[model samples]
Target: MPEPDEICGVNIAFAVVGSKWKPTILWVLAGRPHRFAELRRAVGGISEKVLAAQLRELERDGVVCREAGAGFPLNVRYSLTPAGVTLDRLLEPLAEWGHQLQRGR
Candidate 1:
């Protein structure tokens, strides 16, 4: 993989949000903070382990924020950081293109 600084701007963007699960995770979290189970349901077909791993990666990338409360059953939630919000905006055009393709327009 090319170092982010070595790549063009587009490639750098892809490097951050290119994964199959990462975009979905970001999109869902863009709506509002959600618990782990809510994210799993919103992003259907993702397994618990995979979701956990992806969330960890996103957190490391500074695009996702993970919060947990101190309680009997831990209440964990995920939300987009300001950087993640910017990424969500950047991806909007690509999403529109996908919609057009789906519509055959």
Candidate 2:
């Protein structure tokens, strides 16, 4: 099997983080796990339809894990998985870079 460095440069990974609202969403979750509504609010400006779609996609991508609670009204919460935690660590520098860019302006 070829190593990642052989197959591609870091651009592929950036593409993952480059997604719209994903960076902001991840930042919010880094603070604390949030349910659907909470995530939507934190991500502010994302439409409901799009927010739901993004959450589903994030869960599928293993960035977020969904836990369903047993209850009359189904309760579901989303938290960063270990994989996501690692990604968050990687993103910290990106966040700093963004800060620098803003400051430079």
Candidate 3:
């Protein structure tokens, strides 16, 4: 049901974070933890449904941590896990490369 190329390490990594929104979500989480609404605003242009879905997938992949505060309003915060921090570090060079390309360098 999957292509041979999809079984490799690189592909496996991509499978976890291959979506357009995942990287942006991770980028925001990399800074600090954010409540669900705060995260939605920070990630801008992504629908609530999509953000919810992405966060769920990231949580399932062990890249994001969702903690619910014990309060009446139900404050839910999202942050990156250790593995996510490492992944974010790896993405830094790639982001730099993207910037370079954008600047026509």
Using lDDT as the measure, the top candidate is 3
Clashing residue pairs in candidate 2 are: none
Candidate 3: segments with Cα more than 4 A from true spot: 1-7
Q: What's the true lDDT of residue 25 in model 3?
A: 93
Error of 2 at 22 (Å): 0.6
Clashes of 2: 0
What is the per-residue lDDT of model 1 for residues 1-105, given as tens digits with 9 covering 90 to 100?
866765787776787789999989999999999999989999999999999999998998899999998997889889999999999988889899999999995
lDDT accuracy of residue 48 in candidate 1 = 98
Candidate with better lDDT, 2 vs 3: 3
* Candidate with the larger lDDT of 1 and 2: 1
User: RMSD of model 3, in Å?
Assistant: 4.2
What's the C-alpha lDDT at position 97 in model 1? Answer: 94
Q: Best candidate, TM-score-wise?
A: 3
Clash totals for all models, in order? 0, 0, 0
Q: Which ten residues in a row have the lowest lDDT in candidate 3?
A: 1-10
**CA shift of 56, model 2, Å:** 1.6
Q: Estimate the Cα RMSD of every predicted model relative to the unseen true structure.
A: 3.7, 3.1, 4.2
Report the lDDT tens digits of candidate 3 across residue range 13-94.
Answer: 8888999999999999999999999999999999999999999999999999999989888888999999999998988898
Tell me each candidate's TM-score.
0.84, 0.83, 0.87
Worst 10 residues of 1 by lDDT: 3-12
Off by over 4 Å in 1: 1-7
Q: In model 1, what are the clashing residue pairs, if there are any?
A: none
